[model samples]
Target chain A: MPEAPRTGELAPELSLPDLQGRATSIRDLRGRPVLVTFLRHAG
Target chain B: MKVRDRWDRWEEIGAAAVFVVFDDPDLIRRTMLTDLDVGALPFDVLVDRSRGTYTRWGLTRASWSTIWLDPNVYKTYARLLRSGARLRSAGTDVLQLGGDFVLGPDGRVVLSRPQQRDDRPPVGELLRAARGSVEGGG
Candidate 1:
């Protein structure tokens, strides 16, 4: 299993589509603090 | 995850929160968002249909016992029920463990946590961590 990135490590590049299908990437959010949460199943 | 008006506080603190889910976006929007009466979230909620993000974050399948047999999950459901929230039918991926992370302005992780059972930290606590990470510069 790939170990999660630890504190002080660069976050893995996360580029995905939003609900509207627009591509979004964590790399774009650099220079700003962000809280990323992975949710299981909403249904 | 009753964000509603509380997200303004997150924005005020100069921190953004993004929700990453490995599911169909429309299904998630209809069933979950509407049920919670939450509309037009101020933050980005990315869809990870391939589970690639989960994999990168080292989140894997959770054990059946860790979910169904966990008393805390039931207790949390009961509490939500008392608060008038309806129970969602079987989750799409009960085995897929979830997680939380705080990334600093420099794009470095300041905190990394994998969810266990029903133990995700409250939004308030998350905001504080995010704020601290930014202010402390990782």
Candidate 2:
């Protein structure tokens, strides 16, 4: 596993597809504080 | 439940809440529609089929013992079962762990909470951390 981004470090850019297959990136929400929660799995 | 409960507050604070799942989008959509009674989620739901996001975020895989032996896991399972949610054949990697992160407007991580068990960090704590980041501009 890669190192998790530490506080004060830039969040690694994430470009992933949403449920509707639309691509979304973390960089696009830069003007707002983003709370990103990673789930274990969809199940 | 935390995220869903505080959805409006998160938006009120000018924060976007995104959920990244390590599974295919179809499975996610199906599960959400069939098993959950909650209407559409208020925030974004991203699918990371390749688990690249997990690797990049340094999330570890839970050991078999960790999954089976944890009481919290059993409680959660029981609760879901009681709520009419049935266990299906696992389609994704069950061992993959999860975490929460609060990123500032500048794209820098403000808070990170890696799951130590089956549960996630409380939404209140996440909100507090986010509020602190916004107030302190740290």
Candidate 3:
């Protein structure tokens, strides 16, 4: 099946902390095309 | 099997940003530094220690029991639990969901792989889709 926030849906603006704990928001990448991968915890 | 080895293999087709969130931050950091197994995984490898992301996404351990409980699969934990006194007691099964989302410059999702079971993806396919998005096909 296809993923959520389907082809035409707008991605929710997420302001997550990077590895260094710096806040990075999705809106920050407003100009360049972005590829987002929601990954799982390595078990 | 060394999970990091597979990670090294995917590093070659660089373009799409790579990120890995691990349950154990200490273990991941130690293994990455000492073993140098995933030396070339160009992007940040972060921690999901509290499982905040898991719950937010509707991913649950119970949901994946069928996959891990299959008799044909050879999982170390399953085997170990089987030989114990409480052998048939079904153990906790964790489901790890992953996928790629191609977002346009406007922060809209154009393509996504919603049902992947693990973090690994076909490098060729991912790059192709990513390239297509960059070309405005998405």
Candidate 4:
């Protein structure tokens, strides 16, 4: 039931693994605009 | 089709595109490699095994009725069928909802849209919001 971050608000820090299994975080890409999409499943 | 089509635009803007999925990296990698032939995507695909990201983003599970009764779902299924894609077992959580978000350079959210059905917030809308965020120095 957590609420999504609203516009003009800081996005929640995200730490997840890439396809190659390397750990990646949203905070690391701070200098550029990012489009993040959440998918229901891989299929 | 949308993200791939606008790949160049995203590159021109120096914006990063990331897809977060509630499944294993291996599964996603296989799907992208086999199901899609759009070459390499100019974005990173991340794995959210714990669903923590979804929770923080307020994405919830869709009801059974919503999944089956939604016209968008049927349209998507038909489209996939026409494309030679067969319906397969749900490899992951079928009810898990998804969403799109645009984050500015300053790490602030500019657009947050939680999908209400199988289809929503067209790619054009997302791209426009992203472009606006960059132009407005969000």
Candidate 5:
């Protein structure tokens, strides 16, 4: 298991494909606050 | 879609949300159009096909205790059902857990919410967390 981010720690980077197959990254969304939610599945 | 309801609030705080899913692009695309009724979602939905991000972020699978023994899962399901969420066949790893995280402008973790079971992070609570982290006025 990788280290879980604590409340004050730096978040891990995320760069992945969107539905359109465009690469999106957390860094690309810099300068603004971000809300990242992981969904279990498409249930 | 609670987030959809409070989308203006998210805009007010100049923040955006990213939804990470384990499902493939095709499945998510279909679900977005058919089930979600949104031809285009307001937020970005990133695909985590390899689940590398999941493992790196310390999210794990649900155990027997977390799934079967926990009453909250049933409650959550009931809540979703009450909210018009249907019981559909899961397309990905059903055992894997989900999580929520809020980050400040500096990219530091503000709120890391690792789900204990089937419980999901409420949109209101997440909005509050983002306001606290971003606008300095929760």
Candidate 6:
């Protein structure tokens, strides 16, 4: 199990393909916090 | 916003971004056209393939009981349960449901929640959490 993030600790860097299949990476989200949601099929 | 309002408010928060990893191709199409008008969500909405992100994060929960122990997972489970969400898989498959995650720019996970079986995180709470990070207070 990956360790839950602690206060002041670096977050897990993630880079996943978006719905459009564009490469999105946490490393690219430097100036701001990134809110990533894993959603189920709502269609 | 009303608790039951089905609007996406991620666009309002400063630097607050929203990314939904949908495993279902059909859901991806629907979400794109859903017309969530709550707030200006400035983020990427994406589909997750290969289930790589779920596995890497170890977000697969063992049961509803186990989820309650983890606030992140429980929050999402409660929302789904309330919304009557169904999964593509059956029999204790955690990765098959909706999940929420809060990540810092440096790649640190601040909060992660699975879509609840009942209700999801209130827009107020989600905005508040994102606000904290935006102001560097979280």
What is the C-alpha lDDT profile of model 3 across B1-138, one tens digit per residue?
Answer: 332434443334333353435345454454334444443544444445565554443344424554455543446456656768232322122365545666765666766655444334555555555555556744
- For model 1, the superposed segments whose C-alpha errors exceed 4 Å read B1-5, B35-39
User: lDDT of all predictions, in order shown?
Assistant: 0.81, 0.81, 0.50, 0.81, 0.82, 0.55
Q: What's the best-to-worst order under DockQ?
A: 5, 1, 4, 2, 6, 3
Q: After superposition, how far is residue B65 of candidate 3 from its true place, in Å?
A: 2.5
For every model in order, what is the number of clashing pairs?
Answer: 0, 0, 0, 0, 0, 31
Best-fitting candidate, scored by TM-score: 1
Off by over 4 Å in 3: A1-3, B1-24, B31-41, B46-64, B70-93, B116-120
Q: How much does candidate 1 score in TM-score? A: 0.91
Error of 1 at B87 (Å): 1.4
Best by lDDT: 5
- Please identify model 5 stretches exceeding 4 Å from their true place: B32-39, B80-85
| Highest DockQ scorer | 5
Candidate 2 vs candidate 5, DockQ winner: 5
lDDT by residue (A1-43, candidate 3, tens digit) is 2225667678655455555555556576665555566564333
* Native interface contacts retained, candidate 6: 0.57
Residue B2 accuracy (lDDT) in model 6? 41
Error of 4 at B72 (Å): 1.5
Residue-level lDDT of model 6, residues B1-138, one tens digit each, is 442252355445444465655445445455443565323334566555666666565444345564446676556567777889653332223325555567654555566665444235665665566666766655
Complex DockQ per candidate = 0.81, 0.74, 0.39, 0.76, 0.82, 0.50
List the pairs of residues colliding in candidate 2: none
